[model samples]
Target chain A: MKALEQKILTDGIVLSDTILKVDTFLNHQMDPLLMKQIGEEFAARFQHKEITKVLTIESSGIAPAIMAALQLEVPMIFARKRKSLTLQDGLLTSNVYSFTKQEETEISVAKKFLTEDDHILIIDDFLANGQAALGLLHIVEQAGATAAGIGIVIEKAFQDGGERLRERGIQVESLARIESLQDGKVQFVKETRRVEV
Target chain B: MKALEQKILTDGIVLSDTILKVDTFLNHQMDPLLMKQIGEEFAARFQHKEITKVLTIESSGIAPAIMAALQLEVPMIFARKRKSLTLQDGLLTSNVYSFTKQEETEISVAKKFLTEDDHILIIDDFLANGQAALGLLHIVEQAGATAAGIGIVIEKAFQDGGERLRERGIQVESLARIESLQDGKVQFVKETRRVEV
Candidate 1:
């Protein structure tokens, strides 16, 4: 994850102590080559789980998840976000509260896409409070599918989301983990050197 | 485009005369291999344009756009959709009306991502009413960027979007052009066999 960490240092904008904007090459505008590499890295890391599908939230997660799915030779499914729930049938739904947006949104996936036979790898762009990952995990559980692991591009380690999932014994792998973003500087965790760049 | 056409006939659900649900592989639950093929197809079609960037709207458009960008070795930018505009500066914004959802959503891109020297290839999942394409074209124009061409996965030729763009002398390449969707059957435009699968 050295390239990603380096890109964050070079292009990432520190909007505030709690907000890091990587619109240049991560989310709003993206680098397809970097995304492909990120996907390869995720696939390499989770290749042992025998993943049948890649699951992620809409918009941001689709890029890496699609690429990883391609590398893993599996299907990729993005859970759709809805502002209002209409009580649809044959849909697995979960509620997520975004601390950044300060709003509650419902995420859903078609039940036919997931089954007891599938092992899913959940992927996302940012893991701050881990609400989005939790919501995706909930949908995966509802379908009777096994969550192989969670792949995150960037994780705010100062927050409790990553720790919460780890506490549940869920395998969480974040490519870039931020130790702190205080004083307009991004501080990555120094001790964990096992993750490849 | 035979593979795409065949996939549409096999997995695509023709909901009505105007709506075709391709969530099985094109949007919601996507096949990565098919999507990779789609990206390659788009890249081949627009290879002669010297495209500096690939552009598209968020969510559905990201998959194809990213793949095309990867093949083309360029950056991809997805316009962010906003239900309510916050009047932000340094953004190229346009209004797009979704005929399916029957709502007006403002789409915007960061000003720095696009430039006058850039030759952009606009990619999208569908070309139904062409409102989304029009909005993207407007943003390109605002940035003083030249649009090399527009690449669409499926074009509802029964609709007026394709005609409108062609009327403006824009080079539009649609992988699958539908002649009709009558009696719950998907009918592709028969004459244009120039597009390779």
Candidate 2:
């Protein structure tokens, strides 16, 4: 988490009060070494839970999900943003509203991939409004699977998404939580719940 | 290579004459162990080349690209399908025609991520019509970067993509090459060239 926090402070750019661009090392351009460490941290944190699968949305989430899956030694299922012709007809779909794109889009996972016997850990690059995480949670619920935990690289703590999920008693863990991004400066939450080193 | 070839024969679904779905292990639902082996295989194959960075498209390609980057201990850069508001204005963009979607979409990478001194190895899940690879190659050209090699998980030999790249003298290494998928039976082309195991 320290490494991730450091990377965010060093390489991440605060485009505006709401948007933080981490294309250099987090999403668009990935740092495999850092991802490995983050993956290890997730595995260490959730090793006690029975995580059968790592679920994530397309594009940004794929890298960290893959790393976490490798660390957990479990299968990773990515929900495609667009329905591909190759995808099967039976699917677990959920509507996601993208604050960045300002569009409502559907994300889905093939029903065949997830099942009631599985415990899924959701992972993603960023959690702002939590629409993406909520959509993934919906899909997991539709499959009758248990939500073991949620792992995120960064969380906009000033936003209500993290608080909302916590209000529902869902276990959410983010590597770095931004307290506020005022005046083009990223502020980290002064206090956080204890996590395993 | 034998491991990958065997995985294809066992788990790969021959969807149609031209479509072979390896989503069970390669894409949508990913097997991390197999992906590790794939990364090892790619590292073995491209060991002689100077690969500064591993390049791939988003979604499907992210896993293998990250795995390969882990093996190579290099940075990985993925081209995003759409430009988000967070993305910088300066980028290397290319138009890619999707066979499945039947549309042309633009892919872009931040200009700072890629450089003329970088030796990029392009990796992808499938090379059907090779449009995606072509688009990635174009991005590399736009960055003035040299492509060290191209590693593909599966290449549809019946399609013109692989031939087109080879015709252009790009070093392409496909783990499994399918000759045809007639009657839902996947047929692999005989391994004519030596592959690092």
Candidate 3:
């Protein structure tokens, strides 16, 4: 978590007051070594949970999710942002709102992957509005599976996504929690609260 | 590679004569253990190349790319299907025609990641029409980087993508090469030809 926070401060670009882009390390251009460490961190946090599968959205979340799946020794399922030609008809679909894009998109997962017996852990790169997490949770619910927990690499604490999900009693664990990113300076939540999750 | 072929034969759903769905393990619902093996195979194949970075397109390609990067101990970069809110303005963009989606989408990568000094090896989930590979090659060219090789998980030999890229003098190593899928009976190109490339 410290490595991630420090990397964010060093390599991450703050395009605007609200947007913290860690694409250099986490998303667009991925540091696989760092990713493995981050994944291990998530695995360590959710060590007690009996995770049958890890769920995520396509694109950015795939790397961390895959890494976490590696550490957790579980299979990972990424929800397709759009239905492709290869994907079949029977799917668990949910509408997710992207705060950055300000548009709602229907994300779907193949129904065969998730089942009632599965204990699913939702993972993603960024947790801004929690819309994507909610969508994944919806798909997990649709499959009648248990939502064991949610693991996020970076969560904007100033945003209500983390708070709202926590208030909902969902066990959300994030490696880097951004307290504020105002006036081009990034601020993080104190490290003392890292173990409370 | 044999394991990948075996997985395809066992879990792959042949939707039609031309379409082979490998979402069960290779893409959608990814088996991390298998992915790691596939990644190691790629790394072993490209062991000679001094690859500074690994590249791929987002969504389905991210997992294999990440795995290969892990094996190679290098950073991986995924070209965005659409420029997200986090991505910047100075991007290397390419127009890729998706046969699956039946549409042309602009894929972009951050210019900062790819450089003239870098040696790039492109990784992808599938090599069908070679449009995505061509697009990625174009980005590498734009960066003035050396395209060391291409590593594909599955190459449909029936399609022109693999042939075209190989004809262009690019090194392409595919784990599984399907020669024919006529009448739902999958036929390989023969395992003897695996070592030629």
Chain B TM-score for all candidates, comma-separated: 0.95, 0.96, 0.96
TM-score of chain A of 1: 0.94
- Poorly placed runs, candidate 3 (over 4 Å): A192-197, B192-197
A140 Cα displacement, candidate 2 (Å):
0.8
Q: Which lDDT tens digits does candidate 2 get at residues A19-41?
A: 88888888888899998898888
Which residue pairs in candidate 2 have backbone atoms (N, alpha carbon, C) closer than 3 angstroms, thus clashing? none
Please rank every candidate by TM-score, starting with the best: 3, 2, 1
lDDT of 3 by residue, B105-131 (tens): 999999989999999999999988999
Instruction: Choose the strongest candidate by lDDT.
Output: 1
How many steric clashes between backbone atoms does each model show?
4, 0, 0
Point out the higher-scoring one by DockQ: 2 or 3. Answer: 2
Looking at candidate 1 chain B, the ten consecutive residues that score lowest on lDDT are B80-89
Model 3 per-residue lDDT tens digits across residues A76-109: 9999998887775899999999988878999999
Give lDDT: candidate 1, residue A49.
Answer: 94
* Global lDDT of each candidate: 0.90, 0.89, 0.89
Residue A117 in candidate 1, Cα distance off native in Å: 1.5
